[model samples]
Target: MHMGKSYQVSAKVDEGMLASALGSGDVGVLATPVMLSLMEQAACACVQDCLKEGETTVGAQIDLAHISAVPAGMEITATAEIIKIEGKKVLFKIFCEDREGIVGKGTHLRLIVNRDKFQQRAAAKVK
Candidate 1:
């Protein structure tokens, strides 16, 4: 996808998504890993339309800060904007917010790959 293209994905925090429930922390709130998944979900949607059939994007790296805690039952939205594209690599600026304001922000890197080929490579690792 070209630079500046953007997309958003939202999710409601629940007991299953909490830090205590996910075992990421002792406190009851949104977990960092879950927040990052939402961010990656947004990034994937942002470039879905640009991919050819049998192609998909996989997360390569993520650098983010979970700046605030979102308790259960609150909805949060993550927005991803394409900041740069280098060959098969795509870089995105990500922001996650709750009803009040921003809760997280960071950058993510994704690499485009043929879906079947990528799956095959991963499956080969089990052999």
Candidate 2:
């Protein structure tokens, strides 16, 4: 995948995405985990068209900071840029923003993997 590739994904915060509903916290605001999931979605979109069939990227690490709380009903956008690629690992710089301004920022790492192989390994664990 080419460096500097970027993608953006957005979602409207709802009750199901709230920190209180997610059990991450007791506040009636957007959850940190939801923000992280959006960031991961943007990152995946950045490289999705480049992946071969049966290949996918799995999140490996996330170093993010939720700087501000977003209340439900606000629209949030997450943007990710491919900053580095090393072997099978890809690094992305990501950030989340609301109508006011940036709400979170951080880096995330994902590793390219064969989907069937990864699923097979995961299934084996239950057997």
Candidate 3:
């Protein structure tokens, strides 16, 4: 994928996405894990159209910070931009926000892999 390519996705905070429900913390605000997942989703969408057949990306690393608490029912957006690509590794700059302002920001890494080969590797672990 080309550098500077980006994608954005939006979601409404729900009870199931709360920190308390996700077991990330005791508070009822949006969970950090959920925000990270959304960021990953945006990153995936950013490069999906550019992938070759049978190729998919898997998250390899994330360095993110949750800066504010978002209560349930609020809408939030996650945006991911492709900042760098090195061989099969892709780096992204990610940010999340609500109507108020930015609530999270950081970087993420994903590795492009053959879907069947990756699944075979994963399946081998159970054997």
Q: Mind giving the per-residue lDDT tens digits that candidate 1 earns over 45-107?
A: 999999999999999998898899999999999999999999999999999999999999999
For residues 1-127, what per-residue lDDT tens digits would candidate 2 score against the true structure? 8889999999999999999998999999999999999999999999999999999999999999999999999999999999999999999999999999999999999999999999999999998
Whole-model Cα lDDT per candidate? 0.95, 0.96, 0.97
How does each model score on TM-score?
A: 0.96, 0.96, 0.97
Per-residue lDDT tens digits of candidate 3, residues 1-127? 7999999999999999999998999999999999999999999999999999999999999999999999999999999999999999999999999999999999999999999999999999997
Residue pairs in steric clash, candidate 2? none
In candidate 1, which residue pairs clash? none
Model 3 ranges with Cα > 4 A deviation: none
TM-score rank order? 3, 2, 1
Instruction: Give the top-scoring candidate (lDDT).
Output: 3
lDDT of 1 at 72: 97
